[model samples]
Target: MTFAGFLGLALQTIKAPRDVARLLLSARLSSEALWTAFALVVVLNTLVFSATIALMPQDGFGLLGNPVAFMVVQAAALAGAVIAIASIGRAMGGKADLAQVAVLLIWLQSLRVLAQAALMIIGIASQPLAAGLALGVSVLGIWLSMNFIDEAHELGSLFKSAGVLILALMALAVGLSLLLSLLGVVPQGMNGYV
Candidate 1:
């Protein structure tokens, strides 16, 4: 797609996400194409992340500071989210399949990378403005996700999409907690909190 097409779709995602979701679903991207796009977005996100860390070095990224490890975690987290959306939506009687969810999520992630890049550049000029824009993008991301999920699953309402999102997030949190516990990554006395 040309830059104009990309910008148009991105704007549409913010303006009319359900329509964009429908358009994406209708594209019927092949599984291979979807996976390739997913990987590309994940890598792009990792690159953006590395840039962020370089620009504002933090105290404790630890394992995540390693680019390859960060990419692996990023891919896993994204894949898990796609699976959760598909599985939970189906369990809740919605109709979207894994590939359908994956495509929308991959597109969203691609947009997120672009937003992060823009925010990084803006941060170089004005930190407070960049921070405010980041907050706005986050809220926009949540709104977009609700619309995308509703359209993908034919959920028929933003309320249902919100329900699905909540459930998926809860599941992911519990699953992550369990995984960290299993790996003994949770610090002593902090297990309950996690």
Candidate 2:
């Protein structure tokens, strides 16, 4: 897609995520395509986030040292999140299948990467503007992801979906921590790397 088309798609995701999800699901994307999209989104996010952290000139990201390794860990955490959310959501009586959950989560992640890229570019121009926009983007991302999980999983309420999301995030964190420990790799973070 052209850059404008891609930007339009990203804007649509922020403006009307439910409709975006509906259109994405209506396409009946195949399992392979879903996986491909998920991987691409993960890689793109890792690249953007790593670049942002590297360029920060300041600490607090909690993802310090070994950018390559950090990216790998992030990818693993992301995969863990997808699996955990699918399992937990189902256990909580979510009617949606794993594919639906994966697709929506992956799509939202792609949007986040786009937002991060924009934030980084804008940060280069104006630190104050970037800082304010960064906070807004982060909040909007969390809210949108929660809503996406609820809608995609057919969960009845935001609270139910939030519960699932929290559990999934906890699971992802533990899984990543364990993986990092196994590798015996530690770097400096905001409060001493994870």
Candidate 3:
């Protein structure tokens, strides 16, 4: 697809998530295309993360103490979530394959990264609006993903798909927290999240 086509798809994912999910899941990409999209999403996410750290105020956070590790963990968690959802979703009679699930997740995440980049750019002009939309962005992302996943899988009900997604997220969160704690990444008595 051309650059304009990709951007149009991304906008559709935000504005009309179910429709976007239909188109995205219907297109059969070769393994090369799938991996290319995956790599693009990861690289873009990393760049956005790096820029976020660069723009944040430095108090006790030194340049060396960036959340690069957290980003790695985040990526792993997303991959794991897709696997679990696809496997369990099949058992629950959903039709989306693993490749479709992975592609949809990457597309959803790319939309989020784009929204965050826009928020950061707009923050330069209006802090309050940016701050409000920052929270909105998080909610909207989850909503979009919930709808996208449901549509892609032909999952019978929105509520059921959302429940599955939420459960997957909780599992990942707990698993990551446990793993981090075992590694002494998150010290005891403090919040478990990065």
Candidate 4:
């Protein structure tokens, strides 16, 4: 897609996320294709994240300091999120399959990469503005995810999708925290996330 087209879609994703979710779901992507795109999006996101971290002053964030490790963690986290959303949504009577969930998430992640790049550029001009943009983007990400889940699962209710998202995030946090602890990969200067 052209840059303008991408921007238009990005705007649509924020303005009418349910419709964007429907458009993505209607693509009828195969599981393999969805997974491959998911992987690619994860990698792209990692690259942007790593680059952003590299350019910033050395913070105490050791986990994000290692690109390879960060990439691995990112991939695992995203895959877990996909599974959690798909399963939890299904248990909640959502009709979306794993592939449908994957597509929406992958598209969201792709947009995240774009947002990250924009933040990086904006950070160069004004740190405060960049911080504000990051906060706004984070909020929008949550909102978009809720809408996407609702659309993908045909839940027809943002409240149900919000519940699924909350449960999925809680599960992910617990699971990742445990796995990270087991692997002795605690972030520097921070207690274990429980």
Candidate 5:
């Protein structure tokens, strides 16, 4: 992840919705680059989450009942998320600019990580609600940020689209997590299977 890649993603996310697609299609980044950037963001976000969990001392299942196992599961879950997003991007007619898609993904997903981190610090009881709110707000923020690229901004339309996008992404993430868990590919607690 070069600085340019970071800035490009940030700038693209802040561009218009139509422009976001345009930028992604134009850049045509590779799958490797896209996955790498996604992994980096997930790892960073997971670290923050792990730290929060460590500090809070929760008693429930506690992310597979082991911190290391939890991190591995989270990492796998996030990778699946990246695959899902890339598939979505492609289905949306993105022409496969790996670098650009990577940037866009990083920018869009960073907000989610930040939101989750914030929710975690707030404690588990409020975490779910806070996470949902953050998810909505972050998506809206990204959408609104995109509209700023041009002079004629349609705030209402952008907000509505953002809401839809947020919900879709959230569903996709949850679905991927559950699917992985069910497949028995993801390790349970501290025990290894194989």
Candidate 6:
């Protein structure tokens, strides 16, 4: 397929989550659409992340100390986001193209990262309530972002879909972390064993 065809398929994938589900579940990737969705998402994510990072003060500190570590954490978060979106798509009986899934995940995860940076800059108390509030806002931002998709209409439905996707992804991440902990392979700075 020509690059234009790939671009068209990618655009369609972004416009319709149900179609993404159909394609992904069928395990069929048309030449033009095969990896286009994923690439688009990653590009979108990188743009968001770059903007966030740029806005953050260079001297600022976060959960992860070094810039490299922060980037790694962000990358993991992006992966988690993809898993969450994919899980939601699966639950909704739709297929999510891997590319589209990756894009969704990256975009969603970037919101959280941006929120964290904003909270840190504001010096918000890192209490449970504060954390919960921050998370809620971040989730809302993600939901709002989803509204840009042609297939998603109504703020309520968008919130529900984004919430389910985030929760599903979080669950999967927790489960994987637990398994790793149990095997004594949990990463450094991660407390608790499975």
Using TM-score, give the best candidate's number.
Answer: 4
Candidate 3 off by > 4 Å: 58-68, 187-194
- What lDDT, from 0 to 1, does candidate 5 have? 0.55
Sum up the clashes in candidate 1.
0
Worst 10 residues of 3 by lDDT: 57-66
lDDT of 3 at 168: 72
Per-residue lDDT tens digits for candidate 6, residues 1-194, read 57586556545644654464344434444546534644444444455445545654343344334444444454555566556556665566544544555544433443444555555545334455656777777656554445432132222455556665556667768865654455444355545553
Question: What are the lDDT figures for the candidates, one per model?
Answer: 0.88, 0.80, 0.75, 0.88, 0.55, 0.50
Off by over 4 Å in 2: 59-64, 187-194
Worst 10 residues of 2 by lDDT: 185-194
Cα-lDDT of candidate 3: 0.75
Q: What tens digits encode model 1's per-residue C-alpha lDDT throughout 1-194? A: 99799989999889888889999999999989998999999999999999999997776666677898779778877888898999998888799999999999999999999999999999889999999999999999999999999999988888988899989988877776665455445455665886
- Compared with the true structure, the alpha-carbon lDDT of candidate 4 equals 0.88
Clashes of each: 0, 0, 0, 0, 11, 7
Ten-residue region with minimum lDDT total, candidate 5: 147-156
Error of 1 at 74 (Å): 0.6
Pull out the clashing pairs in model 1: none
Sequence-dependent TM-score of model 5: 0.50
Angstrom error at residue 96, model 6 = 2.7
Question: Residue 188 in candidate 6 has what lDDT?
Answer: 51
lDDT of 3 by residue, 1-194 (tens): 77798798887777888888878777877779877877677667777766765775434433224556655665676777788778777777788888989888878777877887888788768879989999998888779878977887788688878876887788778777776666556453456464
TM-score for predicted model 2 compared with the true structure: 0.85
Alpha-carbon deviation at 54 in model 3, angstroms: 0.8
Model 1 scores a C-alpha lDDT of: 0.88
Model 2 pairs in collision:
none
